[model samples]
Target: MRYLAAYGGENNVKAGMLHYFMYPSNDISVMPKEFLEERNATNHSNIGEKTLKKSIDIYWELYKVKGRLQ
Candidate 1:
């Protein structure tokens, strides 16, 4: 709590920067890019397309911002 306060006083909760302390699955292997691509192509489409697209957009934006900062 003290350390987090040093960062920004905890008044602001930034998305994509701070994640839950514990995640349901810590294994990244379960959601590989190829697997997501294949699932997205399938008829049923395991995950919702809109949700996946939004996540991808967020990643791209973060990447761009990081590159610019450096």
Candidate 2:
């Protein structure tokens, strides 16, 4: 398991978000060009798309509210 405590915002979250999604456990093989561009205004990673959608889906399922709220 891994934990991250980072500020929210485009700039503040980019590097951390990238690292999270690219972590070996996540198995993310590609990343959206726009995302990498926004990360550093350059697309040197040469990764592809569907990364955002995949990451969001994983996040939603991982952090989804389960059972009844207390």
Candidate 3:
């Protein structure tokens, strides 16, 4: 919990940064330029409540899958 404080603001709750973290290292060279442009264009604050609900569903699925891995 203390570590999450470093990211600040809603970042601790935001899935966008988590998607980046789970992506293969920060090797922009490996990612397509168009994908990078799209990532940069994302406006998290403007995201609708439905998206957040979907994210929660994804989080639960990921949690279940991760538990199965062990």
lDDT of 3 at 27: 47
Residue 45, model 3: Cα distance from true site in angstroms: 3.0
lDDT tens string, model 3, 20-69?
43442434223456776666533333455567557745664554333466
Candidate 3 or 1, higher TM-score = 1
Model 3 residue 42 distance off true place after TM-score fit, in angstroms? 14
Give the alpha-carbon lDDT of every model.
0.37, 0.43, 0.45
Q: Rank the candidates by lDDT, best first.
A: 3, 2, 1
Count backbone clashes in candidate 3.
0
Q: Could you give candidate 2's per-residue lDDT for residues 1-70 as a string of tens digits? A: 1222333443334445565444522233234556555553322232533675466457645754444258
- For every candidate in turn, the CA RMSD to the true structure comes to 14.5, 11.5, 9.2
Show pairs that collide, candidate 2.
Answer: none
- For model 2, the stretches where C-alpha displacement exceeds 4 angstroms are 1-49, 68-70
Give the number of colliding residue pairs in candidate 2: 0
TM-score of each: 0.29, 0.27, 0.28
Per-residue error for 33 in candidate 3, Å, reads 35
